[model samples]
Target: MRLNQYIAHHTKYSRREADKLIESGRVNIEKTKATLQSVLQEGASVFIDGKRIVPKEQFTCIVYHKQKGELVSKSDERGRRVIYDSLESRFKHFVYVGRLDFASEGLLILTDSTPVAKALMESHLERTYLIKIDGEVTKEMINAMEEGLVSEDARVGGHSKSEIVAMEFAAFAYYEILKNDKKYSKLKVSITEGKNRELRRFFGVFGREVLDLRRIAYGFVNLNALPCGKKRYFTKEEYKSLHTFLKEHSTKESKKIESRH
Candidate 1:
């Protein structure tokens, strides 16, 4: 793999950030300063800013019920509130699998296995949200959303400007009109792609403002009764189940290495 990608998979940094680190001489490959275009061979050693790098043996996953106002990042220069502050001291290094915007609260997955995090984030894992919009929902609006609409503000790959890609509505998702509440409506939304401000943008297409948005579930994992701003370690069975699921879906490189005859 490319050295920057390898660093990203093994460390807390993103791939783009890893490139910057390499360019700045903060990363070393086999005790030598790494270049931005370095290619890493199997079994090659790596280090970041003099810290020895080692792949995780046993992976750990956790579900965190994030609360509003908590930033979903490892560090912030602006001194903003962050979710890492709420994690146990021993789990301070775990990477978040996906992010929930600071204003939005919901179930977030954290894991020690970078490969697993990469897989879950890059594969467009399904996420379900319970959203409250500040406007009445009409049948026409619901049908239009179900049929998918394009947003003029959507951008692809940071360069190509186009309409927002329409996501398929899950079967159980629908809008609920509240009694005596003429201005607000609640909806259960399920989406596969985790784009920036996706649910809000989806509703924006219909001219409805999102008053509140909370993720209810991710994959087979659900927040259930977990309260906001709290976290729980994954049960042994839950951990095993995730590993088994990953193993089943893993590609050749991610599987156990086998010897050739």
Candidate 2:
């Protein structure tokens, strides 16, 4: 693994923070100061500021209702608000699975297990969202998205496929509605892929502007009854379900890597 990734996996700091530490000469490999470009071979001992680094003992997963204006990163160079500030102090080395933009807020999964984070974030795991758009959605646009439309911007690397899990049209005064006027319409859209600003861009193609976006679910996890800007610990069963999924996926990936070797 890369030096920064190794340090991030072993420390409470995020990957970006780990890179900063390496650049500042705070990280060491085998008692020698190391840089971000350094590589960590298998079974190599690492240290941070003279303290031996160790793997986390217990893993924790949390469901946080991220509020708008809070950056999802662990540390922002610009001194912006971050999600870590609201996390419980008892957690030693937790990292977020995915990110929500500063203007967006909803369910975000945080975990101490790097492997679990990697599996959920880097894989094809599905995520669901409820979005409020600025105008009435046309049936043609809905059909096009369901049939997998080719995005003109191509911000998402792979082909885009969106299925409207549920659709509801109501007055513009819902609590979740960020915009309310006689000219605008509200929609709750759900998609599997969690691409960057995907919901907004998807609606943008149809000339609709997304006023507000909120994630409601991720895989088997849901944000039911969880108020905005608060967090709750995952139940034992929820943890077990995630753990098993991660273990199975990791094992398959490891075998694939071995075969390539």
Candidate 3:
């Protein structure tokens, strides 16, 4: 494991924070100051703030962009294109953190840790999307989104209540109109929940047609500089940020749930 990952996995500090501590000369391996590229090898002693950082299970994380129409299944029944086809054969055991429907595209996380995925999904980890929809995206529409929407289909999700069952309405952390050509406009929306085809249905409430949709960010990890159909291992900083976000979100969620009762 890398030094930063080691600190993050075994300690509450995130990978980015570990990097700062290391650069500030607070971390040491065998009494030598550690660098970002420093590796934690067997029988090596690592100390941060005069305390030892015990090594934990080394985890591997990958961020991949799912190309549209590339099915997310392990294997297609009829042999259609799938996301795994683009990944290295060695990563066959890894499971995707979340599902992106066949028609949807953008940042996807592949990892062997089920606990990590569960923690994130149960929390309010934010997902950001860049979507291009037909027709003008007006201020009124944005205001409606922020207030939330009641989907026509309750089986999927909505906020309406009548017979004692109430569903969550899709809400946004922020919405930005990136481009507006009148006929077609590009938008950036950040959402906290992963409702099934929520964006499509959310826009449908306004009678808009979604042309293109892509996830640009998840939590603190950004899908930058990576092309479609390619995968890369998480750097120490990214790994740390992922863990930090999960921990903070999990704590906040548990508190919210407890307060409700």
- Each candidate: what lDDT? 0.73, 0.71, 0.77
Question: TM-score: which is higher, 1 or 2?
Answer: 1
lDDT of 2 by residue, 163-195 (tens): 432322211211233344546766555555566
How would the candidate models be sorted by lDDT, starting from the highest? Answer: 3, 1, 2
State residue 138's C-alpha deviation in candidate 2, in Å: 1.5
Better TM-score candidate (2, 3): 3
Q: How many residue pairs clash in each candidate?
A: 0, 0, 1
Error of 1 at 126 (Å): 2.0
Residue lDDT tens for model 3, 1-261: 457656766776776798999999899998888887676787898999888876555667899989999987799998998888998889887778777877778999887765465566655678999999999987767777789766444432222332423234666888888888778999999998987667766776677877888998888778897898888888899989877786676567557745976
TM-score of the candidate numbered 3? 0.68
Residues 1-261, candidate 1, lDDT per residue (tens digit)? 667657766767777898888888888888778996576878988988888778655777889999998999987899998998888787787879878887789899998777788777875456888888877787766675566555554332221344545543332333444421457888776777776676676666667777888998887778889999898888777777677766555544333322321
- TM-scores of the models, in the order given: 0.67, 0.66, 0.68
Which whole-number lDDT from 0 to 100 does residue 2 have in model 1?
A: 65
Model 1: per-residue Cα lDDT at residue 258: 27
Which regions of candidate 1 deviate over 4 angstroms?
Answer: 1-55, 154-181, 252-261
